[model samples]
Structures are given as structure tokens and as C-alpha cells.
Target: MDQKTILVAFGGASPEHEVSVITSHQAIAALQESNYSITPLYLTKNGRWLTGETLLDLKNFEDLKKLEDSCTPCTFGQNEFGQPVLLEQKTGFFSKPKTTPIFAVIDGFHGSKGENGAFQGACEMFNIPCTGSGVMGSAIGMDKVMAKTICRANEIPVAESVDFFEPDWVDHQSTLITKIESLEYPVIVKPVHLGSSIGVEVVMNQESLIRAVEAAFKYDDHLLVETVITPLMEINCSVLGSSRAQRTSVCERPIGKEELLSFQDKYLNDAEAKGMASADREIPAKIPDELTKAIQETSVKVFKLLSCSGLARLDFLVNEETHQFYFNEINTIPGSFSFYLWKESGISFTDLLLELIDIAVEDQNQKARRIQSYDTNLLSQKAVKGIKGLKSKK
Candidate 1:
């Protein structure tokens, strides 16, 4: 049998651009040992879509300018047979552009449009199978305020937070500050729609709180200020499969330098080649088995509530003293695809990726079974004539 082409799509105009590159490279390396043919779909910071063999190499990313210059500019389109293809341009006058059929798309993106359903919408338009959460799930997972609200409504414990847009802050600065202060000092401020700890800040006092909020607005229009959960222990669990049938991986306790985990702690500190998998964390987190069971169960609940599919890592903040935890955030297209957690759960990295592809294909097949359109034409000449005749009688 011929090898199927799995388009490993990543990189975007977000703060997590470099991280996404690392993730895509990681996925490509694992898939290389598999039966499927890997195709690199690199989206530059400026939003240019390109693909080529050069993108599959991790070393090329060190100097992105030269690397992008070596890639072939491409876009999503269909071939003569209406099958989805990655169309690339040719410079020569007589040479026609090349077209490669896409069997599926591996959503390896980290933040921004890549993980927030925009890219998923593109895949749906092109009628191609893409991994990870669908549009609704991706969009909600990316928005912190929305995710919290939904979880709260579902009786899931979430830290109390005060959310406001940039305009709300600008117009009612004092009022917003007062409301946040009610949550008390030393709160966690976050950009509502960003991840990788890009604009997350732990503010102790009012002065610091104002500064943090201001800084966070630079990355996103909306911000969330939640009461700090000190004596805090950050535990994360990865959920696999779809909303219909899902399972949670072993819980992990991530170590941080300060009260909160910074971006440096997650990817910059000991990161070598594994991306998020390189982050310092304790697998089968040193918590009671009972607590671990609770967290794992909660993780699966949030995964299904958010309508997530493929794989997602759910972060939770636990009170070290009380052993109580609150659902934090969800990484729809988690960095390194959260293969590290799955590895500890008895699934290898390659196997995890293969599972993601299988889930994507299954999702696409299920969608195909749905009734999409009607058999009768509402815009037919007979229909139009009847409508005109009725109008005349009226």
C-alpha cells in the first residue's frame, strides 16, 4: 500500500511561535519512523503558508529567514478529482505548480489562530481531516474566561476570577481594580486567549496588579484575574480519545521557580529537543492515589465538557494543604502533543501520534455520515415562479 501523507501543520503569528516550531519538528521526527509520509506545513509569523523537505529538519529553524526562503509557498486547494491537496507554486514560466494529496492534517500548533479553531475551520472548508479538538472545542479551550464560565456552570470547581476586556479596563479602571481587589491581593492575571504562560502574571499588591493587567492587555484584548491559590501544587493530566469515549493519563506535578510556573520553566529552562516533554515535572505526581484519581476524573470531565478530541493536557491548581484543586486551563493542541504524559501512561510517542491520526480520520468519517444538504433545489425556476404567483395573490 502507498504511504498516506500526513501534513504536520504548525507555527503561527503568536507568542508561542518558536515553541510551535519545536513541537512540529518533534512530531515530524516521531512520524518519520512510522508508515505514513510526513509533509511539513510551516506557517511563518507573517502568516505565509509554506511547505518543503527543509522544514522537516529541526536545525533549519535556528535561522528562520533563510529557512523560510528555502521552503515552497503553498496553500490548500483541490485537484482535478476534487481531492484535497497542498498546492505549491513553480517559478519557471512553463512549469506547472505541484500538488500533493493530503490524507490528514496533524494540528501541531500551540497558540493563537492555530489552536483557537481558525485553522480547524480551514481544514473543514477544505474537507480534510485534522487532529485535536474541533472548532467549538478549540475556541473555548483557548479562551480562559469562557472555559472557566462553562466549567463553573457544570459544577466543576474553578478559582473565582474577574474578567474584563481592554475597553472595560480603560473606561472603569478604578472599578475593575476594586472588583479584583475584592478577590484580594496576590492574584493571578492572565491574557484570556493565550497560552504557554505568555502573558500570565502573579501580582501581589495593587501596584503590581495594575502593571500586570496593563502588560497582559498587550497580548490579548481580554484578561482574567483570579484569586491566588497559594500553598499551590500544579498537577496536569492528559486526556486521550474523543468526547464520546475518553481516558486520562497519569497525573504530573510540574515544578516551578516561583509561586507560579513561568514560560521559562515550561520550555526555556531545560528544554533540549523534546519541547514541553522536556519540562521538569514528576510523573505519577507525588500526591495521594485518591487525589490523583480525583484529578484524573476531573480532567476527563473537562475534556468531554469542552468537546475535546484527539489529545489535550488539562492543568489544575491544587491547594497543597487542603488537597482541593481547581480546573485551570486546557491545551487543545498541547505542546509536543502531551506525548510525555501519554508515555508514562503506557503509550509511546509514535503510538500516541498514530492514535491522533486515527481519531482524526474517524471524526471525518463520522461527519461524512451526517445529512449535510437537501435533495430539492429551493432556488429552482418552478419554486421562483410559485413564489411570484403567491406574491401577486397577496
Candidate 2:
């Protein structure tokens, strides 16, 4: 069998671009290089795409000008067989065109175009299998408000939230403020279309709410304000598989110094400070067994409810005083793919990647089974009639 070439796409037009680069590098290192051919596709912050041997090195990213010069610019297209093809610049004038089949797209995109459905839609347009959630799932996952609504409809427990679009906030600031004040103090303000806690802010009072909203508005037009669950303990659980068949990995408790997990605390903090290596998480969460079970069960429920595929990490906030657990968010394409949690469940990173690839292929096959085009062409029948005959109906 020919070795399948996988496009490991990383870096994106997101605040978490640098983080995506690190995650992609980790994935590339874990992949079984002997079994599959890897293609490093780098997406710049400006949205330009490039690919080359130089991208395989992490240091190349430090120097943007040198990195751009070393890599060949590329774009996505379809092949003759109707498969997704990657078009790369030819090295020499006499050389034949170089293209490769994008067997799978390993998405490391964090926000907007990456976490949202843009890349997923592109994959669907070309009928290619890509890792992570499908278009609808990706879009819903990126929007916290939408995810909460869907979860609520499915009887899943989520925090109460009020959403405000840009126009609504601009036109009815008073109305928006009234709605927000009703929620409670220390409400969490978030950019509706971001991930990895990029534009998340915890507002302690009306004054802080205004400042947080102003900061969050810089990132997205849509915003979400939800009552903060104080005395909170953060627990994250990773789910693997599709909606039809899925399993949950061991739960992890993120030990952060702050009341809420900040972007820096989640990603930048050393693991030793909180215990555990790589990202500071306690495997199987030190919480009561009942709480652990509840979190795991809820994780699976949310994954299936969202129609998430491959893998996703669901975050939860447990109020220490009340012992009430509330859904925070779901990361369809989680950073580091939440391998640490899965690792405790006896799944290695390499095995996890293989499993994700298998799930993607199965999803694509199922989609292929669906009937798309009819045997008879409606256009042909229309052409048989005269132009005047068609114009008569109009």
C-alpha cells in the first residue's frame, strides 16, 4: 500500500496561532514517520499558506522573513479524480507540477477560521476526510452561546448565559446592560467566536464588566456574558469517537492559581506547580468518585449532543460550595489534542492519532454512501425545451 500523505496544517489567523504551532509540532514528533509521509503546511497569521522542508523545524517560525523565503507558497484545489489536492510551487521551470493528495487535514486551528467551520467546509467541498468535527459541529463548538443552547435543548446542564451581537450592543446599550445586570456580579465575558480562553474575562462588578466587554469586543462582534460560578474547580474530560459510538477518557482537574483558568494559567504555567507534567493536570481528577463519574458521563453526553467527531475536550466548572457542576465549553480541536488525559487511559499519542484517522475515514465513507446526484439530469431536460419555452415560465 502506498503511504498516505497527511497534511499537518498549523498556525492560523487566530490569537492562539503560536499555540497551534506548538501542538502541531508535538503531533508531528509523535507520528510514526516510517508508516506515513508528513507534509508540513504552515498558515501565517496573515492567512497565507506555505509548505516546505523548513516548516518541519520549530526554530524556523522564529524568523518570519527567513521562513517565508525558505518555504513555497501553496493553495488547495481539486484533482482530476475529484479528490482534494494541494498545489505547491514547482522548484524549476522545466519540472512537472507538484501536487499531493490531502488524505487527511490535521487541524490545529484554534479560533475563527480554524475552530469555526471554514476549513471544515473547504474539506467537505473537496470531499476529503479531515480530523476533528464536521462543518456544523465545528461551527457550533466555536460559538459558546450556540453550544450552550444546543446542550440545553438536549437536557445537558450548562451555565445561564446572555448573548449580544455587535449591532444589538451598539443600538441598545441600555437594554444589554439591563440584561447583564440581572445575571449577577463576577459574570464572565467572552468573545463568542474564540477558543483556548483567548478573549475570556471574569467581571467582578459593573465597572469591570464594561472594561471586559470593551476588551472582548476587540476580538469578536458577538459576545457572551454568563454568571461566574465562584469557588470553582476546573475539570476537563476528553471524548473520542463519533456521535454514534463514543468513549470518554479519564477526567483531568486543572489546578490553577486564579479563580478561573486564564489563558496563561492553562497553557503557560509549569506543570510542576500544580502537579503533573506538560500542562498541569491531575489525571482521573482528585474529586470524589461520584463527581468524577458525573463529569465523565456529562462529557460523553455533550460530545454526542454536539455531533462531535474524532476527539473533543469538554471543560466543566464545579462550584465548591454548592458542589454543582456546570458546562463551561467544548473544544472540538483541543490543544495538544488532550493527549495527556488520554494517555492516562492507556492510549498513546501515536495510537490516538491513528484512531482519529480511522474515525475520519469511516466518517467520509458513511458520507459517500449517501445519494448526492440523480441518474437523470434536470439541466438536460431543460435544454431540450426551446429558450422561449423556458422564458414563458419566468
Candidate 3:
């Protein structure tokens, strides 16, 4: 069999772009060249798509201007036969277009358009297999309010939250504040669709609540306000596999030095402290056996409920005083692909990457079995009466 070509796409138009870059580099390094060919696709902050040898080097990213100049910008679109093609400059005077079979796409994108299902929809249109959740799952998981709604429907324990649109908050400030005040103090205010703890504020008072809401609105049109769980211990578990079969990795207790896991504490500070050596975590979190089992089970349920495939990390906040656990959020495209957690389960990073690719191919094949089009053309049989005959006679 011919070696499958996998596109390790990263550095999307999201706040987590730099983190995605590091993730893609790690994946590219772990991929086995014998069974698959790796192509690095970089999505610039300005939304330009580029692919070239320069993207593979992590050092190139340090100098953004130079890296952008070195990479050849490209565009992706379907060809005459409905095959995906990449159009780029081949030479100084001539342009070259190439159409390579993308066996699978490993999405290292974290948030925004990339993680919010836009990229997934594009990949689906091109009939390319992609790792992680599909359109519905990605969109739902990215939006905190939507995820909470789904969890509530599924009887999953989630922190009580109130969602408000920016327009409503701006127009009816007093009403919104009254509604928010119904919940106790020390609430968490989050943007509807962001990750890496960006625009997440823990408000301990009414003044902070108002300020947090204002800050959150700047990041997204919708905001989620939830009562903070006192004496909170953050626990995270990685769930892997498709809807049919899934497994939960050993739980990790994330310890942060602040009131909440701030953006800097989660990524920037950790990166500066560890230099990619290891992420700060406590593997197999020090918790009771029953509590561990419950968290693991809930993690698997959330993964399947969200229709997520490939991999995802489910975060939870456990109240130390009450011993209550509440689902925090889900990361469809978790940082570093949650390789460390899987590694604890005896899966190497290289093996995990290969497994994800295999899952993507299998999922794509399964989807192909469904019938997408009808043999008859309904438009041809339609009349121009414009619902004249559709009126019901009472």
C-alpha cells in the first residue's frame, strides 16, 4: 500500500496559535515516516494558509516576519473532479498547483474558527478525514453555554450558569445584574467560545462581576457566568476513541498558584518554567478510588455525548469541602494532544498519533456508508405557484 499522506495542520487564526505551533511540531516529530508522509500546514493569525519546509522548525516562529516571508502562501479548493487541490507558487515566474491525497488531517488548532468547526466543515467538504470531533461536536464543545446545555440534558453534573448576549447586557444592565446577583458571589465569568483560560475571570464581588462581564464581552458576543466552587481542585482526564469504543486516561490534578487557572498559569508561565520538558501535573490525581472512578466514567460519557472522536480532555472542578465534582469544560483539541496522560496508559506519543490517524480513517469510512444524495431531482418537479396550493382548508 502507498504511504498515506497526513497533513499536520496547526497555528490557526486563534489565541492559541503559538501553542498549536508547538503541538504540531511535536506531532510531526512523533509521526512515523515509514507508514505515513507528513505535511506541515501553517495557518497564519491573519488567516493565510501556507505550507513549506520552513514550518517544521520551531525556531522560525520566533521571528514572525522572517517566517512569514519564508513560507509560500497557498489556498485550498476543490478541483474539477471535486478533489482538494493546493495552489501555490512553484517558481519565480511560474505557479504550480498540486493535488495530493490527504489521507487524514491532524488538527492542532485550539480555538476560534479552527476549533469551532469551520476547519472541520472545510475538511468534510473536501472529503478529507480529520482527527477530533466533527462539526456539531466541535462547535458545541467550543461554546461553554452550549456544552453546559447538552450536559444538563444528559444529566451530567455541571456548575450552574447563566448566559447573556452582549446586546441584552448592554441594553438592560440592571436586569442582567439582578439575574446575576441571584447566584452567590465568587462566580466565574467566561467567554462563550474561547480556550486556554483566555477571558476567564473569577469575580469575588459585585464590582468584579460587572468588570468581568465587561471583559468577557470584549472577547465574545455571548458570556457564561457560573457560581464558583469554593475550595476547588481542578482535575482533568483525557478520553480517547470514537463513539463506538472509548477509554479514559489516568486523571491529572492541575495545581495553579492563583484563584483560577489564569491564561499565563496554564500556558505561558508553564512554558517558561518547563521549556517543554514536562507539563505541571499530578498523574493519577490523589483522590479516593470511588471519586476517581466517577470522574473517569463521567469523562467517557461526556466524550461520547459530545460525539467527539480521536481525543479530548475533560476538565472538572471538585469542591474539596463538599466532595462534589462539576464538569468544567471540554477541550476538543487539547494541548500537546494529551500525550502525557495517554503515555501513562502505556501509549507512546508516536503510537498515540498513529492511533488517532487510524481512528480518523475508520471514522471517515464509516461515514461514507451513509447515503448523502437522492436519485430524484425534487426541484425539477416543483411548481412556481409559491405555496398557493399548500394552504390548509379549515
TM-score winner:
1
Tens-digit per-residue lDDT, 278-353, candidate 1:
7788988999999999998999899999999999999999999999999999999888888888888889989999
What tens-digit string does per-residue lDDT give for candidate 3 at 108-168?
A: 9988998999999988887788999999999999988888888989999898878999999
Worst 10 residues of 1 by lDDT: 269-278
Q: Write the per-residue lDDT of candidate 2 for residues 296-329, one digit (tens) a residue.
A: 8999888888889999999998998777998989
Steric clash pairs (candidate 1): none
lDDT against the true structure, each candidate: 0.91, 0.84, 0.84
- What is the clash count of model 2? 0
Best by the lDDT measure: 1
Ten-residue stretch with the least lDDT total in model 3: 270-279
Model 1 TM-score (2 dp): 0.96
Selected candidate, larger TM-score, 1 vs 2: 1
Candidate 2 TM-score to native: 0.93
TM-score of each: 0.96, 0.93, 0.91
Model 3 vs. true fold: TM: 0.91
Candidate 2 backbone collisions, by pair: none
Worst 10 residues of 2 by lDDT: 271-280
